[model samples]
Target: MKDTGLVAMTEFLRHPSMVGSAFPATARMVRHMLAPIDWDNVRTAVEYGPGSGRFTFAMLARMRPDARLLAIETGAEFVEKLRASSDDPRLIVAHGSAEDVGRHLTENSLGYADVILSGLPFSTLKQEDAETIMRVTGSALAPSGIFAAYQMRTAVLSLINRQFVDVRQGYEWWNIPPCHLYWASKLRGEGSYEDQIGGSASA
Candidate 1:
């Protein structure tokens, strides 16, 4: 079996749009991105663009036995790799776009996730697509749930701020090329998904 790093690099070279990053996140980066999560209370977690399952493995190690994880990936190869990497019944690897995270959650019979972690390169994505993902992520999170991601650029910071009520930033220089980690939390009174969509449509 190829190592996770090789697999991730190959996938990125094959599909930059889907893979997002040329290198898998280092252990340090993963730690920083997951630092704010209270695993004991995190019943549901959704990971977007889980390239090589680096963070996924870490999350599973700390999550409660009853907790469930939905790993959503656009790359077929990555999805297959993820499925093969873990046999934990608590994990559900979905092959799809992150923009439709709400549908993925509903299909899995899951309510809003307690935490949403993303490895998708929002800076590399189109502005509209990035905004759509941020909106869907905000609406799909449970009240006060966290949405965390490590990005290579600051372009998506504004989008996150627009959708989430509170936003915090951190840096990890140990990773290759380094990155900025964004920790954003949904507001407690954001209302239901329908309400959010209706408000957006009206605006």
Candidate 2:
């Protein structure tokens, strides 16, 4: 909420190498994809590529007092800003690549998370790196866990859908550039358990 934080966020969003870091998504989009978070089962959440804590704030709002949030970001400046302004005791801001999420969690004793919320630039990632990220993410999920990420189009999602059994689509046309959210959950018996948490079937 500081001026420096806002300025830093703006700079990051405008950077050319990070153009895909469009920083899109309205409050409505945040509410939509993140609303059904199972706070009861979600003892810990691992958020990748949280540039300026937009979705991080939403997650904080929904988490129980005892629950912890681990934010993994590659940018040192962004990580510094987050660690400084993010005063909540439940929040842990780590400076690192999204690909290292598993190691980071393992080092912190948070090996498996109930949910993984990502803001990584899938459209910008190299094909091999993207696949690795997907594989790693899929491997880090708990049996009842869910992975939710937003992309501007379905074209960017083809590789991602290959990993999860139940790949559901959700959208929020209100955001700038709009966005299609991909929700993936580990296969339990048959279908996604999102419905049990009041989540809408991918729309």
Top model number, lDDT: 1
Candidate 2 lDDT tens digits, 20-88: 444545777777778655666688899987776778888988898988889997766667778887789
| Deviation from native of the Cα of residue 66 in model 2, angstroms | 1.7
lDDT of 1: 0.82
Q: How far in Å is the alpha carbon of 66 misplaced in model 1?
A: 0.4
Q: Candidate 2 at 31: error in angstroms?
A: 0.2
Q: Estimate each model's TM-score.
A: 0.89, 0.85
Among all windows of 10 consecutive residues in model 1, the one with the lowest summed lDDT is: 194-203
Candidate 1 residue pairs that clash = none
Q: Which ten contiguous residues of candidate 2 have the minimum total lDDT?
A: 194-203
Predicted structure 1, TM vs. truth: 0.89
